[model samples]
Target: MEATEIIIKCILIVVIFAISLVVAMYSTYAERKIAAFFQDRVGPNRAGPFGMLQPLADGAKMFLKEEIIPANASGLLFIVGPSLAILTACIASAVIPWGQQLTIGSTVIDLQVTDINVGILYIFGVVSLGVYGIMIGGWASNNKYSLLGAIRAASQNISYEISMGLSIIALLLVTGTLSLREIAEQQHGFHWNVFYQPLGFLIFLVCAFAETNRTPFDLPECETELVGGYHTEYSSMKLGFYLFAEYINMFISSAVMATLYFGGYNFPFMDDLGLSQNWITIIGVVVLFAKIFAFIFFFMWIRWTIPRFRYDQLMNMGWKVLIPLAIANIVISGVVNNFLNNA
Candidate 1:
């Protein structure tokens, strides 16, 4: 890459990182507002105009709170846990195709940070590493509840990841590429995979919710049973890191879902309007976030609407239901593709 191109990529990465942080912060406020709406109460109206500044208030409170480490805790690992969680959450977005490319004065700029060929595999690898954060933190705390929560998180992620990978296999078959950028290009102008692979989409969606430790699938941090779950012993910004990481993961997962199945930044008739390349790319980015916010709202809605799953039920769904269905979808997709190729 030229010097200007390299500089532009770095700038884009920094911009994305900043944007992700802000979105994660606001997601907290949005979640509370959503929860309040479901429970029929006002939420966070005092922080700023209609609670716009609630995240700032929450961050300040967390910063001002006492930092505590358990008496018998493994101090180094205890610190490492939430840091790993937050780091993994932040880095997973590197492979996502945010929008189409923009050209400026003979220089072509890709919207994504990097377009590695094995983008999907890279996502899976990073997602699996997320378990270490919970595991290390829980084990270092020397608390039974924390350990149990860590165990739950590790097991849950392992079980669901298989189904999630299988679910994506069908998409890979259809798109014939593992690169997210290529997948997005294939899905231009409403040509989304969701239409052709509805079953795969459903299974992937469920597994994503589980992967992110969201509602109904949130067995790791069951408040009544685990007493705040894995990060129970953490306080101040350490705890803040763990909690903030969850929202970041949510945002990343939402973006991934948009890219993989919903057609990232694609809108119908986008080319018909004859807009400039930069304008089109900008519009695409906005459309992509519109889809992401819709998914985020859906996530919050489901969180309030459903109850947490029993551990056994969660496992059974992952293994017996989602995995098997995903496998079947893959087989069906392969057969259809083979037949189409021969015909």
Candidate 2:
């Protein structure tokens, strides 16, 4: 790459990292606030104005807390688990098309950090590896509860990944590309895939919740049964890493959902307004985040509203229901596309 291009890529990576950190931090506050609202109670209002500084306080507290490594724990693996989880979560955002490219003077700046052709596949690959973090951490702790939590995470992610992949197949049939940027470009403005592939969207959405280990699909961390799930033995920043990674994964999943199904960064009447390319790109980025936050809120709302599923029920729903539905959506999409082309 040219020096300028390399510099730009570095800058983009830094920007995305910063954005991901900030979003993950605030999502904690957002989750609490949403949870409180759903329960008809006030959320954190003590940290700052409307609890704006709550995440900062939370971070400080976690940092100041004493670290603990269990007597029987594999200390190295225990440390590695949360690090892997956070790293995997951060990297998944690399392939997402955050916004359209912008031209500044003579140089072109892509809003995404990277636009690999196999972007969707890359996302799937990285997301699949996230389970290892949980598994390693849980196993290393040498606690039966942690081991069970890790097992649950492994099975849960593996089960849902199949459906998630199948759901993407349907989208691929319609878009004829696996590159997320191309998909986003094809879905300019209101011509979103959600209009055409509603079933695929639903399947993907459910799998996303499962992949992120959110509520209803959060059997891995069932407090009642697993004693804080996989990270039960972790304390201080180690525990914080696991928790922060969850929110970061949530943020990334929200971004991916917006990009894949809701037309990332695209808005109705966007082209009609005769806006500059930079401004248009900026608008799309903002709109994408708006959509992401909406999904995030929906996630929190569901967490508060729904009950956790039994382990068997979670597996049955993922493997039996979502997988079959995703396959059907793919077949239907292919048939319709073939007919449209021949006609």
Candidate 3:
């Protein structure tokens, strides 16, 4: 590659990596503040005005805390576990389109790191790999409770992923493409796929919560049962990596949801603005991020609003309720497609 192209790609990758860490850091503060608001109590107010610097304080605490490994733990796997989790979490953003390309002088810059044709499948594969990190950590800890948490996490991720894939299949039927950027382009303005695949969207959203192990569905890490769950033996920044990965996943999931259903960086009436290409792309990027942050807030809101599901209940919902609905959506979508083709 030319030096300029190499430089640009390196810059994009670094910027994206930094953005993920920063957003994940702040998500903790947002979650605490939101939870406090709902619980009718004051949240963090120390470490900085109105707790704005709380995430930095938390990061510092993580770094300063003593790193500990259980005596019987497989030291290598324990360390590898959190590293793999955070690495996979960050890489998932590579296929995501932050905005349409920008034309600056003689060069055109793509807003995404890479545009693979099978981007959806790529995300699915990466998401599935995340469970290995949790399982390895739990098993390596040599703690029975941690092992149980790993079992729970493995089963939970496997079950939800099935439904998630099925829901995406329904969307694939509608969009006829696996490339996320292409999918976003197809949903130009308000003509988003959500209007056509509402059922699929709901299934995908629920599966997203389950896949992320977020609340109402966080059985693996349900404190009451599994103690601290998979990361029970972890400490210091090692533990922090696992926790931070969840927030990074949340941000990526939010961006994917917006791209798939909410028009990504596209908005209605944007064409009426008559802005230049560069300005329009920038505004689109802003709009896309706005949608992503809104969904991140929703993830936090649900955490504070809902109670955890019992294990049996979580399994039943995934298998009996969600999977069936997902299949039904596929069938319905197929029927509709047949009709449209015939007409």
Candidate 4:
């Protein structure tokens, strides 16, 4: 690669990384305010104008809080757990196509940092690695509750991931490519895969909730039972890292859902506007972010609305309901494709 190309890639990576962190930070503020709205109460209003700086204050508090490692804990692995969690969360964005190319004078730049052909698989692999962090943290803490939480997390992730992968198999049958960029490009002007793959999208959405350990599926961290779950023995920014990783995963999951089902950066009449490439690229980026924010809101909305599922209920839904549905959807998609091709 040319020196200029290398420089652009580095800049893109840094920018996307920074954006992920910012979105994750503000998601906490958004979650609190949204929850407050649902409960009919004032949210954080003390920090900045309408609590704009509440996340910053929270960050400072986490930093200033005393760091504690249990005497019985595996010190190094305990620290490594949250670090790995956040690291996987951040790196998963590398394969996501943020937008179409930008034209800056003579130079062209892709909004994504990298466009691996197996982007979908890459995301799945990274997400799978995230569970290890929880497992390790819980085990390293040397607490039974923590160990139980870790075990729950591992089992929950494994169960749901099977259905998640199967749902994507149906989508891959429709899109015919694993490259997220190609998938996004194929979805031009609202020809979204969700139109044809609605069942697959629904399955994927539910699995995303389970995978992210959101409400209705947050059994791994059932405070009532597990006493803060895997992080029960954690303190300070160590706890902060685990919390941050969750929000980051939520953000990335939102992005992936938007990209895969709703149309990544494509909008209706996007080509009809007679806009320049640069203008289209800018609008596409905005549209993608809008979709991501919508999904994030939906995530938070469901969190406040739904009660957490019992561990048994969670397992049954994953193994019996979602997996069967996913398999049926795949068969249906295959038949449809075969019919269309024959026609």
| Highest-scoring model, TM-score | 4
3 or 4, which is superior by TM-score? 4
Query: Against the true structure, whose lDDT is highest?
Result: 4
User: What is each predicted model's overall lDDT from 0 to 1?
Assistant: 0.93, 0.93, 0.92, 0.95
Q: What is the per-residue lDDT of model 4 for residues 60-161, given as tens digits with 9 covering 90 to 100?
A: 999999999999999999999999888988999999999999989899999998888899999999999989989999999999999999999999999999
Better of 1 and 4 by lDDT: 4
Q: How many clashes (backbone N, Cα, C below 3 Å) per candidate?
A: 0, 0, 0, 0
Residue 321's lDDT in candidate 4? 98
Across 1-343, the per-residue lDDT of candidate 1 in tens digits comes to 5889789989989999999999999999999999999999998899778989989999999999999999999989999999999999999999998888888878888989999999999998999999899999999999999999999999999999999999899999999999999999999898999998999999989998999999998878999999989988999999999999999999999999999999998989999989998999999999999999999998999999999999999989999999989999999999998999899
- Candidate 4 TM-score versus the reference: 0.99
Candidate 4 overall Cα lDDT vs. reference?
0.95
Candidate 3 deviant stretches above 4 angstroms: none
Per-prediction TM-score to the true structure, in the order listed: 0.98, 0.98, 0.98, 0.99
Q: Which run of 10 residues does model 2 get worst, by summed lDDT?
A: 96-105
* Residue 127 of model 1, lDDT score: 91
